[model samples]
Target: MYTIHFETLGCKLNQIETESIARFCADAGFGVTMAHSTASQAETAPVLSIVNTCTVTAKAEQKARRIIRMLLAKFPFSAVLVTGCYAQVEKAQIEQIDSRIVVVPGTAKDTLADFPQFFMDLLTKAGAPKTAEEAAALAKDLRAWQPLRQIPAEQTENRLKPNSKDTKAIESINKFRLATDSFMHHSRGSIKIQDGCSNRCAYCRICIARGESVSLAPAEVLKRVRDIESGGQTEVVLTGVNLTLYRGTLQTESGERKMDFADLLEYLLENTDTISFRISSLYPERVDDALCRIIAHKRVRPHFHLSVQSGSNAILKAMHRPYTAETVVAAVENLRKAKDNPFIACDIIAGFPGETDKDFEQTQELCRKCRFTYIHAFPFSPRPGTEAYTMKNQIPQRIAGERVKWLSDFACKSKTEYAKSFEGKTLKAVVEKRETNIGKAVTENFLHIYIEENKQTLKDLAGKEVSVLIKQALDISGKDEETEATAVLVCDGA
Candidate 1:
């Protein structure tokens, strides 16, 4: 039996795929360990290694390459399987390292056969082939590239929409990564609802890579949620490509009418006490009152994240985003007025092709006005095969970097203010873990609290909700002083 270890670097969708692979390997009788790498372990070295690599940016590609080279050395005797996005995009480059390294793309990542046995057999047939230098030039460019085989997301329309299918599934799975997965810890895992994108944003490669959107059936969804809750996961988060796009995979009561995302949210909220339900990022085009009203329920945490790539209307339109400044503002206004301790976050992309200083400034203004709790900022990088790759008016790296920094700083400032707003306000914050990495607790609104990890007053509070007086807001430096008013959690929600 082979000992195996896996490292996933990228989006949530990749993490789910990695988890499924882990489940697969374990079921195949492989011993699993959570160690950082496959090659070295206190008990024994793994005979196999898998690097679920990401290649969203040039930096990501470099990182993947570097990690692959390092791991390939660590497991000289082990078979290394390179898979995921980087594997899909940089197939030739990965194969150049060693024929021994089996590179599989995202499409093939799923539907893989008993890879361990297949790998063992391949290695046996190839023989040890001795010497790292000799093995380094190993090439497996013997077969022709597979013809483009497109699989439509759950529902198949007899029509084509670019690489819509793939993008949808990819986005569907990504919910696990970017969404609030930490809340569902130690119980049932969250289920991915849909996948792919057809928005064809000029600056995003997601549309090309993930494919078109499709959703799971209401029955399957209910079944999975029940299974997760029964198995002990107290919460479930619904995620996917334009999650609002989730309709259904199978026929249901409302005619062959599949259950939409809003329906599912209502069902979960009404039917189960599965601890909590978190609504991950839903594109602006999909946000609606039905969903909003359900979210306003006292049981539902006052939280929702928007998929806004650019705040400026011109930049947003250029990026092919579906919503505008007013839409995002309206959503925030609704949530703030309805829910308690709500945290609003968004995805902001800076330095797109043709983006002007004025355009970016408008985005800045939008961010300030919205007062988002957090913003994930990314500098535009051209992705081959995407619409944005060849667009004109590209921003320089330095300029893009600067914009990204400014946006990130702005979000952080907003987060600080958000936390301060809760000062003297009572909110339910569950004590998750007290890792030395950081002080730990997540508020109902999803603010990560790192207070004194002291054993009784603090450490003793793990998994318990206390009446926390938000006290003074922590600074960017994370230092605490007497001038800082301390937080006090009084009543236990339990």
Candidate 2:
């Protein structure tokens, strides 16, 4: 069996895909292990390392490159496989990094499941020994397979030509990959219901790297959810590239019917029991009254993230985003109406190509009006092929940096206020980490609560759902604080 260690960097979608790939490798008789750092462990070193990368920002790409180089240096004898959006757009550049590094685009990530077997077959054909150690040693000098290197940067579709698989091998893994029982990296379950993106926003390069949007069949989606529920997980986050764009077809006795993200949520809630559903993110324009009603269900977590790039109408138009500032406020209003004190978060790009002082004020005004729980604020990074890259009137880096700081400061204040709202109330949380006398868990509304053991001894609460009473909200400026506040819990045995 080949030993493999996987590293993921990006959105929840990337994380879910990494988990699926790990399961595939393990099921195919490969030894899957978690290698945290460069210092070698007493156990056997992994022979292969796979880095699932991101391309949302130039900083992310730089980080991927740095980490790949570090992994290569750490495991000198192991071969590295780089895949994801970074690999998709910068294939040639990544290929030039090292001969031992194999580059596979995000578009063909599903094919990676078949790669280990294909690799083993190749070694056998070359008269290498069949033992795991012997095969791993022989695999050290492996280079990129020629056929898989045929994907050009311009190709957006699933046009991979791997030498190992037949025409029947080229199917989306969304239809087959189910929720993993053993989560190697996370406490809760993550089910990737969608992949790829069809939208082409001016500042976005993800659509180019990911290609058109595709969703798992609704039946398969239900099966995946059930699989997670059977594993005793309390929560499952339904993730995707553009979650609001998910469109699945369901087979009913009265012929076939279409299901959007809202319909899927309603169906899953009706069919499944006990497990809670958390949506990764939603487009502001798609959060209508019908969707709000579905999210209002008790099974659906009262936390929503909106991909609202900009609040200024002109800046939004420049970014090619569909909705205006009013639409975002309306979405927030609708969500608040559906669920009391819902934790509403948003993504905001502070410095777009043509943002003026008035435009920036509009963004701040929107935040004030909506009173978001949190904000993922970042300065715009021009991607190579994006329309915003060549556009004039780019915001200066100094100005952009300042704007980011302003929005981020506001977000911190907002998050603290939101965390304080649930003080003294008992909420359901899944324990993420446990120490001797203390534990850390996240509440249903996504608030991080630190559990302090009382007279009872602390148990292994990691991955277990328990009731937590919020004692006090911590000061946001604390140095050593790991969670939003300190929580005292009353577990069954404790």
Score each candidate by Cα lDDT: 0.63, 0.78
The C-alpha local distance difference test score for the whole of candidate 2 amounts to: 0.78
Off by over 4 Å in 1: 35-44, 112-188, 249-254, 423-439, 451-473, 477-494
Candidate 2 structure quality by residue, lDDT tens digits, 1-494: 66888888889888877887887778777788654544454556566788999999999999899888877667666667888888877877887776557777777776776676666666447644334444344444344454355544344232323221211112333333534656766778988888777776888777767766889888988888898898888899999889888999999999999999999999999999989999999999999999988888998999899999878999999887989999999999999998889889999997898899999999999999999988899999987767777789999999999999888888888888888888998888887732422467788999887788743333466777888899988766424454787788766421
Q: Runs in model 2 with CA error above 4 Å?
A: 35-44, 119-181, 433-438, 454-459, 478-482
Using all chains and alpha carbons, the TM-scores for the candidates as numbered come to 0.79, 0.88
On lDDT, the candidate that comes out on top is 2
Superpose all Cα atoms of candidate 1 onto the true structure and report the RMSD in Å to 1 decimal: 6.2
